[model samples]
Target: MKKLLLFLLTCLLAIHLAFPQPPAIRYQVAEPRLADSLDISHYAKKRGLRAGAMVFGLNMGVWTFDRFILKGDYAYINMHTIKENIKHGFVWDNDAFETNMFMHPYHGNLYYNSARSNGYNYWQSGLFALGGSLMWEVFMENEHPSANDVIATPIGGMALGEVTYRVSDLILDDRKGGWSRFGLEFAAFVVSPMRGLTRIINGDAWKRRSTSGKQFGVPNVSVDISMGIRTLELKDEILDQGMGIATEIKVAYGDRFDTEETKPYDYFSINANLNFQASQPVLGQLNIIGRLSARNLVDKPKHYLSLGLYQHFDYYDSDTISVSSAKTPYKFCTPASFGGGFIYQYKGLKNWDINAFAHLNAILLGGSLSDYYKVDKRIYNLASGYSTKMGADFIFKKEVFAISARYDVYHMFTWKGYSGEIDWRKIEPKTLNAQGDRSRAILHAVGLRADIRLRNRLYLTGTFMNYTRNTKYRYFSDVFSNSSEGRLMLTYKF
Candidate 1:
């Protein structure tokens, strides 16, 4: 996990250093290539085979490291163990929250990109992730397969994978040559290695040609990178803990108001944050909202409204903080979620803009901190439920000032748990006795932000957010907790 975070930080820093200023904007429209087309029948079997090989290679490499260097017992697998695992079926494995929630999804991203970069589209690449996860669970590891992993890997992989793929596309340009092209390719490789590898194999890394245009149709994108200091307070206290150096990268891909055509991820927004503090993970939060489809209801000179189906991926993890009499460990995520919503934009006097959205999402599978149940190092519960989210932005449109506010509410229910009388210590690791801490948790969050443009592409931003969790347990008293954070940042937009 530390290594993964470090790699991510290094990549982001390299991008920042490479492009001190935004590149010249170019608009290109070209006919879609057969490889990039939506038709699923035009699959490349060779690329698919290569993707499969890569998945097998990754599984073997990890197993080798774990078996030899780490000497981990779980890495030791045999035909008999594989047979046992197949017979045992799916169970909720007790692994660290970060390992299951963060690392597995990342691994799945690699699997997804293996196919995505190899002439496969969004929907087709997802199959590689699913296949890769199944290979690892049934053939690579000795432990029984996990229910949460199968869901998280492919679904979360699609979200993160597509984001990286688009970001890489935004970086690569075959028209440029020499150091300029080399630098761009290197940065894109850092973001998506599988794509880089495929490019190398196909001799496109250094081969400069007249611009054939982007594989995915060119979409206008806006990027903001921010650096700042943030302080997290437990309950309602101020400055109770040390501050952390916070950095964030926000990307808005494609124009949401463009109602001419709608695709799976044509309009998506991503928010990724990193915190350098003692008590927090290097990755603080990663949120993705991608529009799957849309229909224009009202289109006018002053007002535009559209209804759309969206895909949501949210992940938040923090260390346990004592708040009053409660132990609040801020760990909640919805790796697989689908929702429908409406997007309304009002262009008032002097080009002023007001944007608002409301969404109701069904959480297929999610994780939240548990009150009592603990197995191995796992203290989070796996559950299914729903959420309601709404947000609005008041942009002065003068590029000078903007204010935004958002509210989110989640309701989750855990269906698999053991009684308090059961001897958890004697439960077999391979058995599906206790899935997680059985409880119902409701999480509510409110956030506000203000941004002032300090320069042409620079802004000073201030943000505050408060989170509250209420967990009701079957065998224990209810737990209620609160946490809040405030941040001041300097943001550069591209």
Candidate 2:
């Protein structure tokens, strides 16, 4: 229940960003005579109606699929079950997997589009996502509704939805014609299908408009493609090494200090990475952060403090030899967390930028597969932790070369007293020999990154990261592991 309240409060903050303000144009003007210059009130009613229709259509589609193709009893949702579930209150459900991590966010994306295409702001669109999630929980399924779904769907959805929306916006070209315009529009559609649907519905898909005079501020975007080698070493074990390929994309929205009206997610950064090792996918990570508040501390704003909310996702799955057996077993771990943090930035030194941040996060939920005593199996843990990071970036020779270094520490704790134990086989009462056993882990990482500009919009980049983890169990021996990776890549900036 506490978790539910925390999520609810966070969502409220999101909605606050969407509260109605005095009639003013919020979008940056790219051109003086653009169609968007028309009075917002002129189409307010029509947009509202369209939004409603979209909500209804989405619900209908989900219901039809659930009842017909899936042959589920969602159409006959049990009101009694829902009531009972509500009475029981919220919980950290362990049965959820792909639905919580992927599908719920996708649904939220659809809801966001329903609101955004109708001219709602980013934060306002999140409210629509929440409404849609509530509807599904209350009336769309026969089984009792899940608390996890309600939280993950809206928040995670909004994060991913906004990113998709922005990327689509970057791809769209309204001024072009012929195959070039069609390709651009098609690419945008691939990024945001709901937006495409709404455009077709409104006849905007077939219309051509001059966008040459538009002057919107463009965000900074970069993509990195690297080939790397990674090695993992367990205490006293031989190094396990493999060649890997990694791709990373980062986008930094316009500077926050440049404007007074700091809209939600106006100063945001997004990063996504995928890595494959030895012909198999091994790791993936996604990070999104949006500044919520900021204040200048120096005369020329050389020093500042900012607060932000962040979402983090990490997944690693690999095959390794089990300590207790000769068989190679699969090891996997996935952690997704959301929280807010504070950042301090200093630019007092010429050509240098220094940043430090501390974050407190709720694990929300996570899972792992661990092997004990030759038994290759899966185990799970729920933990909350905090992290601290500090980094410095140095620019040299008129920004022709840049060097950066960072260090981070993370700590997590989990206590299980039989009540939270899912599979007792791995964590037997006798093995623990006591109640209220606690487990803790800490990870330390250091990274170095460098970029060499080869041209105005292209660069050569290199990065190296070293990571170490230490775990302690109340009644078991401590486990220690470490890994290192190095990458060389080409980066393009836009």
Number of the top lDDT candidate:
1
* Model 2: per-residue Cα lDDT over 1-494, one tens digit each: 64564344333222111000000111222322222432233223337667767976898798888888888754665667578657655443343234455567778888887887677877788888888877877667655455656766777777677777766766665567789878877887898888778867876565666552112224433333333333322222332333356666555654544334355555656655556654334334455665544544332467776656655443333444334324222222223466666656567777565555565565654433222322112133334455555555555535567666666566666554233334656553213321122567676667666666797756666655566667676655776766554455666654
Error of 1 at 190 (Å): 1.2
How far off is model 1, as Cα RMSD?
7.4
Residue 45 lDDT, candidate 2, scale 0-100: 32
**lDDT, candidate 1, at 392:** 78
Candidate 1 lDDT by residue in tens digits, 337-419: 88998888888768567888889999998888887767777888888899988877777766587777788888998988877
Clashing pairs in 2: 30-214, 30-215, 31-214
Candidate with top TM-score is 1
lDDT of each: 0.75, 0.54
TM-score of 2: 0.71
Report how far residue 312 has shifted in candidate 2, in Å: 5.9
Off by over 4 Å in 1: 1-46, 234-240, 321-326, 349-351, 424-433
Off by more than 4 A, model 2: 1-49, 52-56, 59-91, 95-99, 141-143, 210-217, 220-241, 256-261, 278-283, 299-379, 413-417, 420-441, 454-457, 470-481
Evaluate model 1: give its lDDT.
Answer: 0.75
